[model samples]
Target: MSSWQIGDITVHRIDEIPLPPETGAWLLPGATPEVVARADWLGPSFAGPGGELHLAVHSFAVEIAGERVLVDTGIGNGKTRANPAWHDLDTDYPARLAAAGFAPERVDRVLLTHLHADHVGWNTTRAADGSWRPTFPNARYLTARAEDAHWAQGELEPSRRQMLDDSVEPIRAHGLLDLVDVAEGGTELLPGLTLVPTPGHTPGQFAVVLSSGGRSAVITGDCVHHPVQLSDPALGSCVDVDPAAAVRTRTGLLERLAGTDTLLLGSHFPAPTAGVVRRHGEGYRLEPVPSA
Candidate 1:
């Protein structure tokens, strides 16, 4: 359970699922040495004989000025995704929201960092007739217009296309999609929240920045997936659309983030998610908020 307050806004993390070994391995390739050296610190980092890996899923919620905003809905319940573990349209996400002092209907906006299945899973819910519908009926679903066009071009890998259909199309079909352009560095989405373009993971991926009372926090979607990447910006995820571009973006972003006192929110970092970047040797390190 990770919660942090910035001015009048409160951010919370709501976990929905975990990735299997194979999926995890796909994300982190050199797991053996890292896992062994950081055994006590490794939450779920591991690799099997077949070179599989483990990963976790987390969704975040932001409450500002009494308005509820959800960021990156985790792999939702009963999503017909390519991955078997992501299948299943039945879960008490709504109940979980209520437990966190929120209701599904109260959500004012759903901002997707990107359109990956895991990130956009909860954008919609399974309807009575077995059709998937927008989960937050009244909230606007925000996504980068460039990303929408890139994935919709029908030239991506088959699996990527499938993810777009299930995770993005439904929101668009419901007339709730807000395809915003994120090319001018950043765009003000809400009063205190801004979308800062950090593309490369996708053609239009962006990070969410919340500024209040002279303090700021950035939700780094996939710009810096793992801590190790901070040490090797040249090392990028296999799924990166343009690895070289991603390296440049990561390097510059890390520099900008480290130069500020911004509290960093990683979409997939071990819980609490609040941290700050600091210059370490030739790379950088994340200093998370102290656990209670």
Candidate 2:
């Protein structure tokens, strides 16, 4: 139960599952041992002693006033996935979410960075009749308009379509999904919570930016998937829709965040999860600021 306070906002990280060591190689092949070894800062946390990148599937829960908001839901339970690590099984994600003080029924918003199968898995859950249903019955699932549009017209892999049928389609069919138009400056979905456009990973991907009083925090969707990207923003994920665009967005985002008080909350970062971005060598690094 790790939580952080930025001004009046309290962000809670709800754990789902940890990716196997091989996840680094499969997801970000460019982050080879030689590449990760160059950035010796990732050891024992983001990466292993042997230079293996450590990643996890988790979601961030934030409650402002009485409105509870959830960022990127992790790989869901019992979903048929192509990736062996994300395949059908069960985990205590729902219980952990409830324990974090933001149960499904209590969530008001589900903000998705993109429409990736992994990020949207928990959008729905199996009901008594065994039909997929929106987990947060009362929450409005939000994502970029561009994101939904792109996937709608595009030909998807069989597994990806299955993901949408169970997780995303149910929300849309239930009138629970909201397609938000995020401008260049970002849209203030809530008083203090802003959804900023960070396209590239997906044309519609957006990072959540929470600002309150003089304090601030930014949730990196897939724009900056791992801290290793901070060491080399050029490294892109295998699934990136626009690899080159991802690198550009990542490089620019890190530059604005570097040397600031803004807390960088990684969507897939391992423990000691929250951190501040700082200038390092020719790129940047996450200066871990352990949760309060």
Candidate 3:
């Protein structure tokens, strides 16, 4: 139960899933050996094949004042996703939310950084009738209008579309989807939370910037996947829609936030997801948040 306070907002990570070898290779090509070794060091529970790379699935929640805002609900249970591991997610995210001191009814909003399956998986859950339904009955599911339009018009490859349907459409059906044009800068959806466009990983990806008590934190959702990417901003996930644009966005975001008092919350960062970016030789390095 990791927690951090940025300004007046309290943030929590509710991880519900993980990445597989192929996914890890897609993010860091030759790091599979290193990744496997690191997993082994963590004990047999973390061990995996040498060629397989597994990344963590991290969902975040922000509590500002009395409003509870959830950012990026990880892959949900019984989802018919393209990725085999994403299917039948066994983790009880709702129970995790309760353990984190947030009841499902308390979530005021759900901000999806992008429509990626992993990020939006918990948007809905399987109902008693065996049909999919919005997971948070009280929360308004927020997404970018541009992203929805792009995927709606474009023909997604089979695997990708499977994710889109399970992770995105259920919210649409509930009419709880709030589509915003995040390309416009500094849109304040919540009191202390603002949407900052961080496109490239997806056509309309956005980062949530929280400010309170003279402090600020940026929830970086897939804008920069790994600490190594900070050293080589040019290296992006193979799934990036626009590789060059992603590099530019990542470089600019990291440059702006590095060395400041601002806290950076990386969605997929190992543990202690909050960190500070520091200039290191040609690029940057993530200085983990100190233990309280």
Candidate 4:
């Protein structure tokens, strides 16, 4: 478990699992061995010495104002995903959460950045009776209206269809789904936490911004998947719905975040996911928090 404290809010990263090199390359088409070697800073953490990249499918547990809010539930257990690697996962995610002191029933709010399979999996779980049920029994599952409508058009892939049925629809049926509009400025979720539109990877993607005691941090949701993107803002993910738009959103985010004290918490980055963005030669670089 990796964690960071921002003012009164404490954020914990619970890893659902780590992605292998082949899977990472499939997700990031531009990331070849030669290309990865350019970002020397990724060594041993985000990238192996042999240029194999490691990515994490994890959730951020944000404890603020006495409410436990989970950002982006990682791929869930027993999910019948289309991707072979993700299909029928039998990991101990709930046990991991409990190990980190975040019991399922104790989670009060669950925020989905977008309706991607990996991001929304744990929204619900399969009961022993084989019925899909909300994992967080009492938490309100927050989703963007635009995201739901976009996926509802039936244009999504087969895996996404399964995701909607098992992860998303169950939350709605459980009377815990809250659809909100992701606007330009921001949508305040809690007192100090806000959801800001950062589309590209998905039509209605939003990143969470936390500001408290004059300190700030951004919980990026696929807007900047890997730290290498900081050095090459133009590097786009193959999964991006709009590659060009993703570049623009990513570069804009990097430009504004560079040289700031704000912490950058990459959603898919490997262990020690929190970092600071700094302006490099022409683009930016991620300065990860020092290992303890």
TM-score of each: 0.88, 0.98, 0.89, 0.96
RMSD of 3: 3.6
Q: Superposing all C-alpha atoms, what RMSD in Å does each candidate have to the true structure?
A: 3.2, 0.9, 3.6, 1.3
After aligning candidate 2 to the native by TM-score, how far in Å is the CA of 98 from where it should be?
1.0
* lDDT string, candidate 3, 188-259, tens digits: 887788999888989889999999989999989999776556655776788889888888899999999888
User: Which candidate's lDDT is highest?
Assistant: 2
> Please, what are the lDDT tens digits per residue for candidate 4 over residues 148-211?
8878785767767778899999888878999999778999978999999888898889999998
Q: Residue 255 in model 3: shift from native, Å?
A: 0.5
Model 2 RMSD in Å is 0.9
Error of 4 at 95 (Å): 1.7
How well does candidate 4 score on lDDT at residue 279? 81
Give stretches of model 2 more than 4 Å off: none
All candidates' lDDT scores? 0.75, 0.91, 0.78, 0.87
Q: Which ten residues in a row have the lowest lDDT in candidate 3?
A: 38-47
lDDT of 1 at 247: 84
Which pairs of residues have clashing backbones in candidate 4? none
Q: Model 1: which ten-residue window has the lowest total lDDT?
A: 39-48
